[model samples]
Target chain A: MVKLFAISVIRRPIDGPPDGRCVLLKGSYDLASFGFFQRASVKEFMSFSSQTIVERTSPATRQSVKEQEFFCHVYVRVDGLSVVLVSDIDYPSRVAHTLMTKVLDDFSSKFEWRSVGPEALDAYRDLDQTLAKYQNPREADALTRIQTELDETKIIMHNTIEAVLERGEKLDDLVAKSDNLSAQSKMFYKTAKKTNSCCNF
Target chain B: MSVIKKVHLKGIPFNILPETLLLAINMSPIGGDERNGSNFRKKVVIIDENVAELCDKILQNLSNTIDKDDLLDEFDIIPCESKLNQSPVIHDLTSHKVALESWCVPYLFKHSYHQFLWICRKSRKTSSTSSSSSTIQSSNSGPRRDSGNIASAKREKELSRKLSCLSESERISKGLLLSRALIIINPELTLAWNYRRDFFHPSSLEALEKEQRFVSLVMSRKPKCPEGFTYRKWLIKKALQKSLVEPSRIQDFISQEIDMIEQPIRSYSTNYHAWSYRFWLLELVLTYDKTVVSKDQKEIMLDRELQKSNTWIKSNVSDYSGCHYRQKLLDCMLNFCSDGIPLLLKELDENEKRIFIFEGHESLWHHRRTVILLSINHLKKCKDNNGSNAPLSSEEYGGLEALEKTFQDKESDLVQQIESKNYNDTENECSQLNFKLCQAHVKWMERRLKWDLTKSVHLEV
Candidate 1:
């Protein structure tokens, strides 16, 4: 049986069996992860595994998923609950490889979580690269909006400090004047640390 | 009693001079003359020979044709002859037949028969009394009064025509003739001086001199006359355009104009036009010297100027002319020294209220930029002379950084002053000072970028 792994995994009603239902997430590994499981009804798991080739790929997977990598939305009924696994049966083999790599990366890179084996890693890599290639504008737009918000908050903090100093007030008294500034500064410190790590490489 | 006076007796007149006969009327005078038949002697004046002849012929006929007895009994023939322009004058003689002897009267104007006829009727009521009033009244006629009135009107029209015959050149040559007349006629006419300036020809030095004189006169009359200020401005601008072509003539023009502008004491600071001319002069002087002026000498002059300007600003805070001078002085000072940043800051501090201060910090900033470049140049020069001796120490740069901070602080203060209008509206020092601040900011930024500080130094931005 084909399996997927994710940290912070949860189940929800499937909106569709195609591209929209196939959700993609990207972050530092500690933030979030995903996993997949096969149901008992899949009897031909061995044959499917033999047909699905395990592979590795470059991160710059600038292409769409091929048809052979699609996985079935397998339902597993436990007690009174029915859950559908989030993948398409018709996904290309390369997409299966990409998705599998993405799952293993989520587990090893951050908090310990269920690990997708080599076959699923190949599928995840394909899936992530495909999604990234198609969603360049949307990703860039979201990043810009967040950065503008951050810059405005930083300006406000700088102004408040300047005003306090100009008035000959002690810096310690600033907390009583503005809690927003203190919270924003904490956020800035965390982001700075993250940015430092990312930039160092 | 015969009222007429006649004397005919002569000694052997017919035998002595047979061809000539003279009959003379005789009177001693109106003053109690005694004329007993043979002793009477008088002369009667007649109008002229023509009137005298006619009177003589009628008298001879009256003697011969009338019977002597009848003439003697019915008519008292009083001899009368007319005299003109002599005292006690008789004007004409009148006669009638003996039956109408009551109508007979002496007519004074008998020399002309038509005048005699008019006088005869006029004398009828006046013969027994004095007659001069009636004769005086008749001689002055209606046409004479009409003619006199026409002549006066003609004389007035002729006088006006003569006045307008003169051209503008002639009128201006008359020396503030229009404005002076206007002052006399309408002293409140402000535009009279303006009209005089317009009528002045741009090309004529004579007209220019007249314009200057006209303005001078107006300003002399009322030192605060705005029209005088405007004309003075026009003269300066015209002079500038003329001087631009031949620079050698500029000195004379400026000297002449300086006298004109300086003459009015009250308007020295308050007159915008005069102040503008002064500012123009400083600009001209700066522009002329900029190319050839040496740095050390220029700095000394600039320092002197700044000191002089400080005194002026203290006395007359509204003097905007010094605005341009302070700006030029600052530029000259910065150009003079390599380490001029601190000096410039100190100078700016001295006259914190200089109009340039509140102006865009651009000029100040540009001056700062220049100082920075000069510092760099000085560094290069020192390196060229002795690489080891050159002061490339970062501590020196730190000192400059401190100076830069002072400049920024001063600029902020200037901006606040502009915002607050920390100046009397009567004196517009703050606005100009604001512009200098902006100019200083720009120049400082340019200098900072030039020093390659932007690349290595992380800006807070």
Candidate 2:
């Protein structure tokens, strides 16, 4: 719960749904409580995080996502390239935003807006390793934290999904209608929420 | 010699019997992508028997490696997966993606893998004189001695067959290491803890200290696990036996222990183990060994706890564990000081802003209910002390009258603000939850106030 669950870079179009299929790096997450099935809830959490980024309206905005116990932070640039960092709620916001801004800037400059090739990806300085490194922010953030003098200016720290959503839009209705999540994931969301089992999920 | 990464002694995930799952940790945050990482492996190959022997060997080797001067911070667990990280160094298993991929864990930690290797080789290598025998001894530490990692498929099959042939006594001999490994992997393994309980010599401070460090490592990964906390309590209980630890150092030892246990409570909320451990420890601190933990020292500890719980509650508006612990702390403090009443009032005053901001949180309301109940008890205490010779006049009573007036006024203001929200908007669910809880609090308070007036009147007559 203290670690970052997943990290992804998405390319959003002005009017259409965002293309978030580029790269998704997951960490060593525990789903031991699910017992029989995998708690790859982080995977579901990853999809949910990317979906939240896709739903954003602002050209350049910073927002927080509190879906159940998970806290996914998003930093969308004016260029439509957004970096998403999904972590446990206890993971600090300051470190998360700093890591995201650095990642987006680095990724934007190094590689063109095309999908990451294995060679192109390997060429970039640790887009993958940065995900693995920042899992324990206390240990890793000190060395890897970019010197982007971010002293908390304009990020809107929304408590829940509804806080960031447009007026009158329900999280449940959006989850039901979204094309990003598969039907099975959508149902699992409902069932997991109903049982209140999503905390570990 | 570098910083010790965490050791996540995890059991290999179920339904897969790969010899061991290798945890490759990056030396630098951004190393040659995958070429460089300290490698270690976790084995959950066979259940209840053969794997026990293998783990016992690795566990013995690992424990001995970690136990030398008890340098825990020197070891780290490997957090990166080996596949995506195709280290030319660990190239063989880099192709075997299924092993690490099938079993997914939440976080990555780094451990002292080289220590394990060094110890195994040292244990095997007596002198410069016979190096061949070293390979045989090293094999026991892992499935293969080639890289200090898991063996290949064909070798793994042969090893499991060989491990099954080991005698029960032989397995039990190294059971100390096996027990620790399994306990760290799956803390739910109660029998492992029970088996290891007698493993340490009672008189040896060194053994207990080593165990204290070991349990701390286990707790870093599994703080919610009861077995780790239970085992820690056992170790402390043993060490606390009159002559076991130095009498002067007992207080220092207990405070250090408190700092160790308190980390999990702050890092992860709703941790009853940390709070319960604190309560149990407090129960000991408050009552036990009067010479070292003096009366005034106990009062200081209670004051410190009140401040801690106050801050803890402010940040965690929804955590019931902190609130409940604060309740116990207040109850204990009342014996030492009458200021629990004012402290309770200050807590309510601080929470007023939080209550206004996060109206839907039930824990906030629940905490308010507890605070009011405690204040009422405190006032009753004041009245009892004053005696029934004359009426318990409001003017003479210490801040009770004003505290009640301030609380009631704040409650009405909160109610008015909550009522103004359009609860008819069915789209917003948390607001509905907030409204219901606020109404319940008001109802509960009205009932308590009525009880308070009647009881005081009865006492006066």
Candidate 3:
């Protein structure tokens, strides 16, 4: 079974300096995991994910990552807005990208880029229902099926989390640099490292 | 290998397998899975450690191979057996059925449901006790209470007593607390909101203010919920109704509502509900306390409203709802204008300026059409009244004629602008459509003017 956990849209700076901040316009997580994702830190993680995906992929390309048991797919539009879908590993990457594209198209048609905000997101709450509808792989649209077939030959799969990191860098560096990381996470990492290195209790 | 007679499974609960099989795959490995299989069945021989690992691997393979339905069918397990039994303990199965049932519900929902039930019971108990005490006291006061008049008097006393109890500030506060909790738990619960509404008097400004704050709280949680907006509107109407005695409060209350709407509109420009509520509010303020609101004050308010609408239209040129609202504002202005022609001309000038800037915007053009039609209608009315108190100086009369001539010129100018911009054919089609609409409007205006001229000529003859 394919389980969609969260979907988010982030607005990147268009034609500005590369280091400009990307704003998260709107996001919705599955109701079952809503509380877990509602925390500011988790939202920060989602934004970070979108930002990294945008930086990694060309405007026309899509990117996917396999982290632990979860799969994340990101599609970047030409206008610097990125739609990110995070789901269980069993979810088809092509379907996720297709869903992202559909959402991006629907959203842009209904609302102007300048008018996106928390209140604006209320108008698009039906997007959550779309997420729920596409959870079953059999319900994938024709475009999604075509993309899946094409992706079977050309898609690049990243089997490990390290695919997102630079050569000579570790996942720890990324986590440490992320502003979204809570203080508790840093302490936990330190304690875990210490426990692993030392045999004594 | 030895006979391995009657191998015993240890640690796992007797009901674990059945519960796991009955529930969906997502809810597998219920609570008992937390405890390792360390408890053994009574009177069984121990197996070798290697054999135990082998047994574990075989069971895991079986779980993966056989679906839940097939596994249950092969084991002769009944799905409803656990649910049918309400007992807390089952000795044969060692099942805590009640505990498991409670554990199945989500934590937040369970807690909120419990609180809701507790509040309901508490309120029921209080009402029952109050009613019983009131009856006992009324009976003890006089046996003649059986007569109709005496009974009504006794009932009146009881009602006053109950009102006095409810009127205590603490009682209202408690009701507020419970209602707030309930509303937060489920914003869609209209009954809870209604109960909360009873806690405040319609005329009490302080209570209305508190209710407004409470509404904001609920709105923050569910911004798009119509119920919250409807309640706020109802509150405003109630407050306004009570403010008739003190007309000064009406303006303040209306301004407060405007402030509430302004914030949301800044973020979501096309919120029709917010705009509709604003229109309703303006109507109330204009009509309410006509005796208290002086003519000068009404004019000032209308002018202020006109300026605000102008700003909104400039920012949201394509939002027809805002344009529609501007029509209403202009109508109000015309109704109370000392000299309607000059005001209409000024409005026409403003709208034309907007049209020149936003040439292809349909809503702006439509607004211009409404303004021109209303202006022409006003001029006709003025002529019928023998131009009494007319502000149409010769220069202004020339301006009005110039405005009408420019209306036709504007349409052709827009078509030329669209052509020069080198837009796609589909856009060309749309502009052509707009041009046709403008032509139709101008033709209608001309016919009305000709009809009026013929009537005047016949009258002269």
Candidate 4:
């Protein structure tokens, strides 16, 4: 079955880089195999990835990450409020970006994102429902149909997470250097990549 | 000393060469009783630059690791040059999920070469002789299982000395085992599949069952293998021709075949081989053994399959193969009986809702088109097969009028639905691809088939 694993609303401040403390985040981590630690590991990876991509993203621009068998889409509004969704490879990229945009527009309107801090904004529970509703991709049909008329070429496509990074920097070095990731999370990252590169389970 | 038992080898030419080399093989006895771990332990490695060495090395491991011996399950053929520092691995898919651990083989399969490697585990063993003096070598426990260290050239020469010293019949038996190993590693090797086929002569029920089990293990490793499915079909057809299975149990046999194929379909998305194999199985049931499977049973089985297809399509909405299959089932159902009209109506209703929700998918549209065409053809058949030149009574035309109303509603609402989706699009610049495709389907039905579902006159019987 197709899956939409995670969704988050991250704010990219005018600073060195956006922190991992996103205003809103929700995901389903049942796809991972590491018992008990699966959710946390998936959360860590998604947060780490979202923060990295959100920082690189400019205002009013959108980009997507197409990894091995999964895709991560990040669509940021002109106000710097970003929405990110990670789904399986077969999920339509256009529908995914459309969901992010529609959710961003609706979520931003309901809550005062500019004035509220991360703690206050976390009280908004619409993201969990949004992720569940859009997991089918059809639930967002009405909005996506309208989004189809827009110029899809405006969305940039990067084949790998490494492609979005600056030159001379590897993803491994970043994972090892990041203070936000725990030692176990980094170990999970290494093992997951190693096992997948040779023979996928 | 190896066991003193009768093992015959049907020989094949060993002159042809292989592309690459490095083989890691672990053999499990094909028969159920070959677990003594004492026979076939005389390892013979050959020192040659040709493919003959690969065969000799296979026999060495086959003897060293095979506790009992009939046939072994070959896992993978790893190319030796990658330097992965990993040995040949076997995934026990029967009981595990998200797991691909290397299983323990009594004898380690070690290949230190640059060309070809073969891996195996005993599915079953059939040898009765257990008088050998070799000790049971415990399998090493690790994430990966090494086949064994590179065979020493001196030991290989010593083992060959024994082979040269063997009786003439023993030499022939060894040749048969060598071909078996080679065929499993490369299932696509048709020449070898039929080569071993002539050797096995699987006419008896027991032998055919054993062969089926052996092929199933190979399929588990490679789920979408067309060759595997085709081989299975050949076996079943042979059985049917020979009347090996009872006629009463033929339905159960075909049902079992359908059950076996679902695994491959589930493992690999949009599996063409599995789906085609399914269609063939249904066709076989329809045509074969009609004496026992009454018309009612056939219809019942078809109805069940239609429901199964819809359930599968619901979960795997993106898989168009399932939709294609569902359409085939629809064709069979409608052609078999007129009760199919109501079921067709229910199916179109579900498809209509699905199209509205997932309009981005072309599969739903394609299936919907097939169903509409089928319904139009059904109506056309009714009108053409009029018993007399008189128009039908009101009751005779009621069911078809319902169908006509549905077609009219769909055609009229399609344009409105497309326009309502986007506010910026006007009538002149409307370029909704989904809507356009639906319109094309309607046009093709009227212009090509010459039977328009949207018109009431076409349904008058």
Candidate 5:
């Protein structure tokens, strides 16, 4: 079931205070996963949310959507395949990682092209079930193609895990420092509510 | 013997400890209870040893507030106590003094101190077993007698007071008191019924179980009262919901509710609300049963329901919601009217057109048309099977004639009204439905006439 696919995450910056862009972005992402990305990009970005520019003075803003168009050139290039996605809002990094994971998972499951994580294993299991039910020559050939891609993802996951494991105490120290910072941030939020004021951020 | 000196105690602070110094006082005793003409002298005053000491304290307190010489002229602060052993002044004390206290005991209750003060006169005149018998002595002007009686009296007074303050349990007790009071006053105070409702909340399993018994009690007392009937309706409706998905369980719940409404032991009067609730219960029964019920049983039940609610229906004829329930009861009776068409016609006022559930002023006409059409359908079925020689009797013919007259009258009026009105934009769905029924009834009657004539011709041949 393996198929050749592309996945990436991009950061798009907007000027307004975070009124409602995150909701539109999440909707667009869900639509895109359902193979409705192009339709959603126009409607959500132009009609639903503030991702549109008026009268086409700036060609760059007019290129794609008013929101994603600004990041018009931000794409990830890997194995000669490029993919564009959303970033630059609050939780940009987390959203990017999740989207990348979903896309990678989808590609590995569909085409058997895998790089890291359990995506290859899931694809193999699905293929195994399908083969049991179908028992077609075409499906058998697809499974053989996926097997080749699966090996590549397994090696990538192992390498990533090994690299992270090598970092040891430095990573733990960084995580501990982040926890402390978050605790302080919560205290600041409490103080703001007591003083009847919004968060400074 | 001198007269029993009357005393008044007022404005004692709630926080003060009670002083037993006045428990030993003596006064004149009552002689007998042989009607008004009985020769009973007022007993002579006997200032005992114990009462005298308490009287000295009373004098001291009176002196502290005012001059001692002016005490007899002003309101005298008298100290009274009952003696331990039975004595005559003890009877005198019961006639005059009241045991008033600021603080209350925890549970045992008696009449209010003011009420007891009124009862004191009766207690003194009647008997020596009066509670004041234990502390006062004749002819000894000193404070020396049993202290135990004083302590117990204080305890009894305190207990009665505490009973007054039983906040949580007060409502049920108060409701019972008010119920008894209502029987004495105006028994028609529906507020007493509401007081009973407020006594229970459906918060716990125990409360729900108790609520069942509570409803039974209320209905038992006042079966015709709307409050009890409505509350029972609510309980049955709740039980109906829990058992709604199952038909037999719903039937059982409905039967239980009907029993509460119909067979309340103490009061046997039927309630309109209860009858209407039974109607609603039957509707749900119809929905859930989805199976045919016994015709005889259903008719009997509906007849009883209508008879019970007849007064309410007559008063609330303009109440369309209530009319809707009547319509349902009619429908149930109709189901049982399979054996005899006359029974159905009678239940529906012998006017088929008035049996409909349509809204607005035309509902009577609409309903009448439906009933006529229904009769025509049944008669045509009878004629189709050539059963004119079968069970077709006077009752059936009379039922047929009534249906035909109702249909013809209603149809002529409806047609006339429709012809006069502009039907371009007015989407009278109900009128349209009635028109359909009118057409159906006409066609059925035509067929029935043809069948009946053909059968008669065959008989003549």
Candidate 6:
């Protein structure tokens, strides 16, 4: 029942121009979960998670938010690369972190950190195989097994995005700060907000 | 993983190809091999050209010699000279022939009417000749004629018994039993499926109903198999073609089909096949039975169907298949109702409420678009038919305006609710979701109103 819907590798700028964009390295979504995100572009998905990262003032680097019907686990590596795993709520958090770590390690070894672009991402198409192999959490790799035994305290499970964000931080401010959003997506969010003003009545 | 090896052989008929014969060979695991878990390694042996020719010759000879009566016998494997003069390469050919014979027997028995008549003629001639010889009253040949007469009577009785045993109804029932057993073992067997279709008597309602029940049983067992659904569709068409005498029965059959499909649709959320079949049934009923189902009756049925769909959509908000079927049902409803604009407006209102409850649900939005288009079409048709500037009824216009006002009121209330919630003290996820929902509702209503106004302008033209 704990099916992995999608795994995406996104590259975020560390100290570049304010116009830093999040590029989708490789992503695979199952057909069953196709309905939930059928209209959402990769940029929208990136914006959803990147917005959370921009909002967080605390030292906690990992977050899980219920998006649509699945829990999207966002694990931001030290070098600004993020591995997002979307799975059902029942999916093990430790397994998700381990899978992210393995994928990140494999991705980093195969591609240069500074040279993160479409070409660099294309050089590592084998990551799709890793995504498929790790879909079954029971088939965890060596790191997953070791972490489950030795580092139980490192896993931080947040019930919602708000649980991790500071009190003064608003989701809207974070969304506005996200640089990955396309013009069309921005217009859509604005239109959606305008229509949602019905709540004000 | 153990690798599979393939060997291609030529000059074999497509029906007796490697894939078909491999399926016939029953392979069971011999023992547990600790590494792979099974000791049996599945192998397909492709015989050389010589064996293929020998197989063809053996089959041809068997077909020539084996009559329908010989096939009906329990253990009689037809003997061919090809088998008697077989070489070492074709030693296992006899078993293959036996298997093929048994497999082909049921098909031949069901279809070979010429063989049945041939046996009838043979029995009738023997009986008549013997009876005629005895009536000649020749003293010297009296004993011989009497003996012949007794022999012919016995032969005639045997032949008649065999003929009754292979009667059409009996053969069909036997075929049904065999196919049911065969399908249970391997539901993908197209040959078995095709063979079963030969037994369906189109005019017999009872036979058609039984076939429906059997297919339902099959679908319940193997929900993913398309063959069962196809067979069910064929049965429904046959039933419809025959239901001209009592057209009400078609309605009953359709209702039963809907009831049957509800389980599969609920169990598997996006079963496109079941949804397609439901659409087909509705189209058949609405279009095919105009004389049988009166206008009033069709309206009532459509209303009931609409209510049923409303319940389905309420429970299954994300299932696009259900939403698509609901749109089709609405299209059918528009055919019966003269004032469809109000109905469409009401549906649009309901869809907005649903989108508010379940934000970012794309199917609901799609359904709203469909409703808008249907309303526009209805308005155009009404103007064309009535030749009036104001195509819509005054009451319908009043209903649309009232619905628009209600949407505005809901939007404002949602905004007030969001504004009143304390940002810091509230549960972040709940408040954020509510905010997003409110935004989505407002956006959808804005588009809905714009489309409605555009269509209303079209009505003026």
Query: Against the true structure, whose lDDT is highest?
Result: 4
Better of 1 and 6 by TM-score: 6
lDDT of 1 by residue, A1-201 (tens): 112211111111133332222111221111011100011112122122111111111112211222222232221112111111222222222223333333334435553222232333433353344333422222233344344333211111111222314346543443335333433232222222221111110
Question: What digit string (tens of lDDT, one per residue) describes model 6 on residues B1-461?
Answer: 22211111234433354543333322312244433311112222223233334443433433322221122111121111111222211111222211122222222222232223333343344455678664343343335336767644554464456455675556555445545544532356565677666544656765566556555544543454567678778777776666633776666667778787775565456678888888887777777647777666666667878899887777466678888888888887766665555666678777766654444455665676567667665655655655354335635445444544544454455445444552442444434555555455445545755423222121111
- Candidate 3 chain A: worst 10 consecutive residues by lDDT? A192-201
Chain B of candidate 6 vs. true chain B, TM: 0.53
lDDT of 3 by residue, B120-237 (tens): 4345445656785555544443443456586445544543453345544655554555455445434676766776665556556765765666565444334445566788888887
**TM-score per candidate, chains pooled:** 0.28, 0.57, 0.45, 0.60, 0.25, 0.42
**Of the candidates shown, which would achieve the greatest TM-score relative to the real structure?**
4
Model 5 lDDT per residue over B1-461, tens place: 43442222123321232233233222233345423211112222233334433332332232222211221111111111233221111111322211111111000011222222222222232333355663342212122224457744564454346344545355345344434223211224454445544443455433454456545533432344455556666665555454432443444455555555544411222234555666666665554534634434444556666665444333222334344555565555545454545554564563332322221333344444445555556665665766553224435446445545654554445444433332441354444554555444444434643322222121111
Kindly give the stretch of ten consecutive residues in candidate 3 chain B with the minimal lDDT sum. Answer: B71-80
What is the C-alpha lDDT profile of model 1 across B1-461, one tens digit per residue?
21322212223212232122212212212222333211111222333333343333333333322222121211211222223211121111222112111001121112222222222233332332466555444453323336667644553344335434655355444324424333312224554545445444567665566546545544433444455565667776776666432454554555566556654533333455555554555455445544443434434444555676555444343344444455555555544444454555555564454333223323334433444344455445555665454433424546434444545555456445544553333233335455445444444554654422223322221
Candidate 4 lDDT over residue span B418-447, tens digit each: 545533443321135555565566666678
Better of 2 and 5 by TM-score: 2
DockQ of each: 0.00, 0.05, 0.02, 0.14, 0.00, 0.02
lDDT (CA) for every model shown? 0.35, 0.56, 0.54, 0.58, 0.34, 0.53
Q: What's the residue-level lDDT of A106 in candidate 3?
A: 79
Native-to-model Cα distance after best TM-score fit, residue B194 in candidate 2, in Å: 2.0
Q: On a 0 to 100 scale, what is the lDDT of residue B348 in model 3? A: 65
TM-score, cand. 5: 0.25
4 versus 5: better TM-score goes to: 4
List where candidate 6 sits over 4 angstroms from the true fold: A1-201, B1-175, B383-461
Off by over 4 Å in 1: A1-201, B1-162, B165-176, B180-217, B220-226, B237-246, B259-270, B285-307, B317-343, B352-400, B408-461
**Candidate 4 interface RMSD (Å):** 12.1
User: Model 6 in CAPRI terms: which quality?
Assistant: incorrect
**Tens-digit lDDT track for model 6 on A1-201?**
346767777776666665565566666555432211113543375446644543341222666666534577777766777777777664555577778777777778877755766664555556667667766555764666576554332444566666667778765566677666654454344333221121110
In candidate 3, position B13 carries an lDDT of 31
lDDT of 2 by residue, B93-147 (tens): 1111111121121111111122222322333333323565556554564544556
What is each model's TM-score for chain A? Answer: 0.19, 0.73, 0.74, 0.85, 0.22, 0.67
lDDT of 2: 0.56
TM-score of chain A of 1: 0.19
Q: Number of clashes in every candidate structure?
A: 75, 15, 4, 27, 40, 14
